[model samples]
Target: MAHELIYMDNSATSPVDEEVLKEMLPYFNEKFGNASTLYRLGVDAKKALDKARQQVADLINADVDEITFTSGGTESDNMAIKGVALSEIQKATDKNPRNHIITTTIEHPAVLETCKFLEKFGFEVTYLPVDEDGLISLDDLENAIKESTILITIMHSNNEIGTIQPTKEIGEIARKHNVLFHSDAVQSAGKIPVDVKDQNIDILSLSGHKINGPKGIGAIYIKKGVRFEVFMHGGGQEKGLRSGTENMPGIVGLGKAAELARENLETRMQHNKEIRDALIEKVTSQIKDAYVNGSLEKRLPNNVHFRFSGIEGESLILRLDNEGIDGATGSACSTHDLKGSHVLAAIGVKPALSHGSLRLSIGPENSIDDVDYIVASIKKVVDYLRELSPLWDNETDEYIGDRFEKPLEDEDIDRY
Candidate 1:
């Protein structure tokens, strides 16, 4: 069995950074206190929470009052959607309670399933389709908006294909229509710059785990003056928006992670992009029939998703694991089932190709050599599996073997 694996699945969740952990340790014990308390201990807790909030807020270019800490990205997305949806219903004197939301088919399940839940409550959702290159048309977006449209929630970057949505354009459209705008920036926050004010986003969601922060901590950036319904109601915590005792350690760590990401954003982006692009070039050129699934230029810096045709993506992933390479196939949250990627299918990839997507999301720690070894290992495992596949019956070699009954040339074999 292989040991000492290379971790290339940053998009799923990043390993916590040591420095960020150090920053959070005090909150768990020595300096622990409820921020809601009025004593000296409470004052200490409030200071830490406020500083952390400022750190997180600075990274997104939002005011401290606009940021509300949550359990994680799911709660943030839920609050952004349900919060705005509820507010829209309560304020509208018209029949706009039967409202509509516009989003894409490739959104994360947090958004997709949340919309599904809203549909059960009379909200109509229009899932716009992406093109072959995994891009939604702006014209289609404009046509989809109606006066009853209450919110436009689109992801900043797709987790699987790394396609960067035209968020600025979409935000402008939402503003022109007087609709609330939200973006799930969990996948794009640290990898790319996100400014709530500049983007015209009324609401934004992000996860700490995606950016080397503690797991269980995240924040929702609600643009000041944008009204939202409280997700939970109790004592006035989180400015009475999300009522609960704060998670001190997790929030501290998340803030440190955000600050660190801001300090190293440019350096990390350039370095990860270099390693990611090198792997893409190596895989596409060396592995026959392997092709990237998203746009070549406008993509996430640390992602390289490829389809190795005629081979199961999960099988290759398991084989890569045996060879000491850690990666992922499809979204980590939805890996329980072996269905082919819905993201690939949304882009009109063939069933055969769609079933073969391997997403190698590089992190700041990966190198060209690590990606190179992974590429070579995938080629070996795929070739061995194809040879043993009963589904394959075409010519595979120049010389006639026990498998082939007639004369054939290896060149006649399908390279893909």
Candidate 2:
């Protein structure tokens, strides 16, 4: 085994920052108290919670009262989508009920699955398509809106391809149409600038673990005066939007992470971009049959997703593991399924090539040396995998098209 591990999967999750952990330590022990309680200890806990809330709100340029703490990204997403849906459904009359929601095809499962669940309850949904660069067309979004459209939900940045959508434009369109707009900003919150007020976003979701904070902590920014129904019912915490005893430690960690992110956003972004661009330049130039997966110019600074023909992404990932480098084939949440990534499919990547896609997301911790090492390891792994692939034709030094055309066998799918 290698002596040191090189982690490059920040898109999936990040290690807690030392400062964030330090801030959280006190909450887990001496300051442990229910934020909902009325006693002195509880008052102290409430003060901490409120301060953390202000930190999170400041990071996004949202009012403190508009931020609602939640379990994580998924919970925040579910609450935003379901909360809006539930509220709209309740206010609808049989004669003129608004039951429509518009979203992109490449959304995270939290948004997609919630929309899918709402479909069973007689809600109409429009799943907009993305272009080859994994970006949805503004025209498509504008056309999707209807008189009954209640919400327009889209992600600020893709978790897999790292494409940054035109959220400000989308927000403008939603505002003009009088529709509530929500964005899953989990992937973009700390790494990029997210101003809810300026963007005209009514609701936004973000997670702690995505930004070097502890897991199981996140927040949803619901614009004050927006008509949204409650998600969880108990204790009447979070202004009755999300109700339960708060995870004080995780909240404090998230606050510290947010504060740090705001303070060093420019430096952090520059560091990530330097490493990411270097890796992309080296890998694409040095490796054979390689292609970058998303819009290179309009993508997240920390993300580098690419595809190498005639090799399986999972196989490549495992080989990299042996070299002490960690990465991912796609969204960590969708790894269990053997089918091609939905984001790749939405972007028109061939199913065969989709299986060969790899995502390397760098964080502030990664250095120039780390980027060089990652590129070198990837080149070796891809070449080795291609040499062993049955689809590779040694005679022509090319991939066999017919072999790729073959459908995946059920047994083969199960192995992955």
TM-score, cand. 1: 0.93
Model 1, 1-416: lDDT tens per residue? 57577998899999999999999998888989999999998899999999999999999999999999999989999999999888877766565553789988888888888988998998889888888777889999999998789999999999899999888888998999888889999998888888887888889999999999999999999988887888689987999998999999999999999999999999999998889888888888997667899998889998888877666777888988999888888789888855556677678665555667789887777776676678789889878766665534436522112252233222211110
How many angstroms is residue 185 displaced in model 2 relative to the true structure, after the best TM-score fit?
A: 0.3
TM-score of each: 0.93, 0.96
| CA error at residue 302 for candidate 2, angstroms | 0.3
TM-score winner among the candidates?
A: 2
**Model 2, stretches more than 4 Å misplaced?**
1-3, 406-416
* C-alpha positional error of residue 103 in candidate 2 after TM-score superposition, expressed in Å: 0.4
Please give the distance, in angstroms, between residue 66's alpha carbon in candidate 2 and its true position after superposition: 0.6
Q: lDDT value for candidate 1?
A: 0.84
For model 2, residues 1-416, the per-residue Cα lDDT tens digits are 47278899999999999999999999988999998889988999999999999999999999999999999999999999999999998888877588999998889999999998999999999988888898899999999998889999999999999999999999999999999999999999999999998888999999999999999999999998999888799989888888888999999999999999999999999999999889889998998788999999999999999998889999999999999999999999999988888788777776788899999998878888877778888988988888898877766778785564755443332211
Best by lDDT: 2
